[model samples]
Target chain A: MRPDTPKVLFGIAGQLIMQIMPEVRTPIAGQTLTLSAALLSMVAQEFDRAASRLVEENRSVRTLLAASRDTVSEQALRSRIDAETADMHEHDFHVSALQAVNDRLRSLLIDVHAAVETTPGEAAAGLNERIWDELKESTRRRHLASGLA
Target chain B: MEPELAKYLTSKIPGSTGMAISNVFRIPGGASRETWMFDAAWEENGESRSEAFILRKDPPASLLASQRELEYAFYRAFEDSGVPVPRMRWIENGSEALGAPFFIMERILGCDSNTTRIQDAEYAPVRDAIARRMYEIMAEIHDFDWKGTAIEEVLAPPAPGECWKRELDHWEQVINENELSPQPIARAAIRWLRANPPPPPDRVTVVHADYRVGNFLYTVKGIHGVVDWEMAHLGDPLEDLAWSFMEAWEWTRDGRKGGIIWAEDAIRIYEEASGTKVNREALHWWDVFGSVKGQAIWLTGARSFQDGKTAELMMPFTSYWLINFQDEIMLRAMGRGA
Candidate 1:
């Protein structure tokens, strides 16, 4: 916390690439060092925003689930929608806690999205479009500027 | 490891004595295997001999569980053909000598396989020639007849109609087994693929599943050796073409496939060499399928690392760098990208 996690990570990554990598004798070892540096750089980026991103995504997906409650034809899926969106507030703010909740919410979102695709109605179509928008947004939230692709 | 390799080579090459292995070092970018390069020297009938060789050994766990023998057979199939490949030397499947199943081949020296190497200005002069030859070699691969050869014996030919289904099923199963979290985009792509299957190819041909720029050995002259045949199989030929056109391998992010040639020119070269008319719709379907398959691979690597099956940093590196990026590529391929 004193030096800031990102600052420390970036410093180490720079050393690994600029100093350590060139000294590595074996090609595979050099590659490992390079990848370790890259991973550290990416982890630094993720560390600064992990909690906020997960929380924002969780809230967004919950809203979609709540809106799709009626559009989903399956009773089981509807029940899941109601259960997941009941509180709509994250009580636990730990990154792991937030990530666990995000996983469940996204899993439920997939089922709801799949169901609405075949439901055959104007309501389903509108919700389907919204779900696609959220899916696109999910990528934007996870996109790393340093990503290789 | 060097001593073990020397002993193995002694046994494989009869009448050889004082076998020695030097320059033993692993190379980067073989995420699916541990690839090492070295020089082997020995005396046979009082004559000293030396050669550069490549050793591909199985890691504890990797992105895919490919069979070494199948890969070896595929390489053997292309021997003496127009498709340039390294000469196979020996294969040891028992793991008794190398600590893992491994195959040795003659190394194609003085050629680079780095994806970004071609993007440099120095390579600009021969970029077009290399790109044209790359697709031409791909055409030669598809035109090759595998009947009664090692490829046919090792791999079962999928019916033309079942090619898309077979591949989609395999990759979807890979996702089901390896995904750490929900993949709604990939799942949606899978559903669309199932609902609208591409019309079967005119005939099943060899599909180099990972045929991309990074997989080949190239130089200012041209591509010399096309490596990485672990995923080779009998399938629709368009699968290889579309996969070559995927955005993930666009190293420059400049829309040039493989950072060398445009899709239009690549397609035209492939058509001229193989004499098969391009089917735009079917190729589009395979392009989308390629992204899902790419996502499945990255997910497998992530799960492998998460499950403690591998300590290789590339696994996690690939997961972080490619998983979400592949999702965006898939969305664009399916006409849903913003």
Candidate 2:
């Protein structure tokens, strides 16, 4: 909290890559060191955005599930979506809780997307587009700041 | 460890009065197996005999869980073929020998497979040649006749039309079994892949399921030996080509497939060598499928790590590095790039 988590991690990763890695004599040990540094870099990136990404994705998936209910003809799927969408607010803002809710919503979203693809109509088409849109947005939410892709 | 391995080698190597294994060291970057390099010296017929050997021992859990026998057959099938592979010596499935099943091969010395070094300006003069030969060897791999070979013993070839479904279903099951969290993007891509399947391959060929730049050993002259046959199978040749073109292997992130040649150049070379036309639509389908397969591999490693099955740091490292990035690649392949 003093120097900030990301900054501290970046500092340690820089040391690992630049200083400690060169001193590692064994091939496997050095490779592990390099990967450790890389892991630090990725963890640093996630540390700043983990909670926000989880919350954003949970909300986005829940919204899609709610909209998909009317378009899907599957009775069980619609009821499940309705039940999941009923609680829009995050009573527990903890990342774990949000992720738990996120998993349920996204799982239901998959079911919704599958069900809607079977029916053909204006409403189903609209729901399909919405599902794709949310899927696209979901990638953006998880995109790393690192130039990996 | 060397003493134990040398003792094990004594039983495997015949007519050797004495044996000594020295300089035993673990080679890095073998995520699917624990690879080691050492020099084995022995007295055969009262004469000094030495060989540099590579040991590919199975880990408790790996990014892949391929059968060692199947992998051995694949490496054996390509020996003396156009494709260069290390000469496989022996394969032991019994774990009692070295704490796990392993196979030893004659190491192809004085070559590097480091991806970053191959992409550097120092190797610029040979990069084009290497890239060209890469595709040429791929063509050879696809052209190899496996009908009466060791390959047939390990793998059953899928029908042309069923290739996509088999691979898609396999990776989808992998994702289903290993994912710790829901993957909406992957799920959507999987749906699209199901909707638009590719045409049957012209012929089923040997698919080096992880064929790419880093998998092959090279000098500035050219590639020497292609390694890592853990995922080798009989399937669509296009799957291997598309996998080589995956964005993740674009180590430089400069749009070059395998950080060497452009996609068009790779395709042209492969087409010319293999005498087959690469359908763009089909390649696109495999490209997306490649991402799904890639993510499944990483997720498998991640789950292995999280479940306390193994403590290999590379597991979480790859998951952190590739999982989300692979999702973005899937989106792009699905024409939903954001």
Candidate 3:
């Protein structure tokens, strides 16, 4: 925390690419070092925003799930939607905990999306569009700069 | 490894004595296999013989669970068939010889296979010619007759209508087995692919599952060898065409396929060479399917590392760098992207 994580990580990545990679004798070793540095840079980028992304995504999927409760025709799926959206508070702020919640919600979102695609109505079609919007937003949340750049 | 390899060569090459291996080095970027290059010298029938060879050995766990024998058969099928490929020498199925199933082939020299190499200003003069030849060679690969070849022995040809289902089923199973977290986008893509399947090819042909630029060996002269046949199988030929057009292999972020040729030119060249009309709607279906397959590969690599089955840093790097990028590409392919 002293140097800040991104600064430290950028320094390490710089050293790996500029210093360590050239000294590696084998092509495989050099490639490994290069990829390690790239992974570190990506990890650093995620470190600062992982929790925020997960929380935001969990909230977005939860809202979508709640909106789809009426459109979902199956009893079992509706119960799942009710159970998952009942307590929407982020009680645990840990990245792992947030990610666990995000996974559960997104998995449910897939089922909801499949159901909505089949249940014929304007509401289902509208909700399906909203799901696609959320899915696109999800990619934006996890996007990283190209490593080759 | 050198002594063991020397022993194996001596045993295989009859009357070869004092077999020696040198300059052995592992090549980079082969995430699915341990590819090593080395030179060997031996005396056969009192004649001095030296050759450069490539060894493809199976890793304990890889991004792909391909059969090495099948890969060998695919490579063997293309030998001297107008499609340029390295000559296969020997294939060992048992792990007793090399700790894993492995195959050896004559290494093509003076060729560059790096993805970014052609983007340099130096290659500008021959880049178009090379790109044209790339598509021409792909047409040859698809037009190849695999009947009565080693390929037929190892691979079962899918029914014309079953091609799309077979590939989608295989990759979806891969994702189901290896995904570390939930993948909503990939799931949606799979559902869409199954609901709207691509029409079957005119006939079943060999689909070079990874036919992009990086997989081939090229020089200023022209394309020489098309390598990486680990995923070769019988499927719709358009699968390869759409795969060649995937954005994941677009190294320069250009709209060009493989950062070499425009999609239109590549499609024209492929169509002319194979005498098959290009179907835009069906190709779009495979383009979206390509992203799903790409995501499955990255996810498999991530799970391999997370489970401690491999320590290859490329595995995690691909997971971080390509998984989300692939989803974005899938979105664009499906016309749902911003």
Q: Which candidate is the best by DockQ?
A: 1
Q: lDDT for model 2, please.
A: 0.89
TM per prediction: 0.98, 0.96, 0.98
lDDT, candidate 1, B1-338, per-residue tens = 99999999999999999999999988888878889999999999999999999999999999997889999998999999999999999998897998889999999999999998888888899999999999999999999999989998888888999999999999999999999998999999999999999999998988889999999999898899999999999999999999999999998888999888899999999999999999999999999999999999999999999999999999999999999999999999999997
* Candidate 3 chain B, poorest ten consecutive residues by summed lDDT: B248-257
In what order do the candidates fall by lDDT, top score first?
A: 1, 3, 2
Per-residue C-alpha lDDT of model 3 across residues B164-190, encoded as one tens digit per residue: 999999999999999989898899999
True contacts kept of each: 0.83, 0.82, 0.83
DockQ of each: 0.83, 0.71, 0.74
Alpha-carbon runs more than 4 Å astray in model 2: none
CA-based DockQ, model 1: 0.83
Best lDDT among the predictions, by candidate number: 1
lDDT of 3 by residue, A1-149 (tens): 29989788989999999998878898888888888888889999999889999989998899999999999999999999999999988999999999899889988998999999888989999999999999999999998875532
lDDT of 1 at A42: 93
* Runs off by more than 4 Å, candidate 3: none
Candidate 2 chain B: 10-residue stretch with minimal lDDT: B9-18
